[model samples]
Target: MLGLKQSDLASKAMITRSVLLGLEQPGRKHPDQLALFQLRDALIRDGLTFVDATEAAGEGVRWAKPSGKVWVDCLKDARAMLGYSLDELSEKSGVGRYVIARLEKTDRKRINEEAARRLRDVLFDNGVVILAEEADIGAGVRLRSRVRPAK
Candidate 1:
């Protein structure tokens, strides 16, 4: 989920790899509260919602369904927020210039979901998160304060 490996997740959360592995293990649970909080915060920032156990449902993670229109409206903003110009976005996302323009249009234009996903994945991988629209609140685009050190 979220197209991430365990090592990537651990790095994002700033948690040690062994600690995260222990937390995931069946019998070797790691009860580091601070690490748990860090991981939770990182996941939340990654466009996931955590559902607590209810009478009818067990605790689970979910990616909220973003409003398509909202996503379209903000595509350009997201690309720009990443400090990527149109050509840069095209290169990174492998979405054509025409498609990007069409998706950014206020009026409906034909563009498939796959193209959108390609663009979205680039933004996600680059630390931009598109927030899902909720009742009484409109959708939003947020830039994570992420700065990974050079390898």
Candidate 2:
């Protein structure tokens, strides 16, 4: 489901394939907290968000923010959450400043996948999590950490 091979995910999570398999199966004993943390980190690093179960809905995954406002607003909001300027984002993402400016200032939907990927990667790398709307969780942006470390 996370687009990762079991062996690759196990390696990334620093756990054995048997352990990962155990976690996947329903009847096995739950993994220790450290193993779970490792797995969570591996998934989160790839932009997979694990929303906790709420009264309204069971747990689920979100890839990006839900559609509504222009996607460019989402980009700008994420950049703002990371306290990065357009120029700074451009430098970090290797996306042109004009492209970013247009995204932020206009409602154009012509951005290529690679360009969008670059923008999203830079924001995610900076700890800005773009959450999609779940059954109850509304779409929004939040930082993984309130006090982010220097890049």
The lDDT values for all models are 0.70, 0.68
> Tens digits of per-residue lDDT for model 2 on 1-151?
3446799999999999998888877565546788889998987786656555445433434544333443344677677656788899999999999888776654575766677778988888877766655554335566655442255
TM-score of each: 0.49, 0.47
Q: How far is candidate 1 from the true structure (C-alpha RMSD, Å)?
A: 12.6
lDDT for 62 in candidate 2 is: 52
- Per-residue lDDT tens digits for candidate 1, residues 23-131, read 7765653478898899998888887665454453334344545544466566776676566887888888888888887887777657678988888888878876665
State in Å the error of residue 12, model 2.
48
In model 2, the Cα lDDT at residue 38 comes to: 95
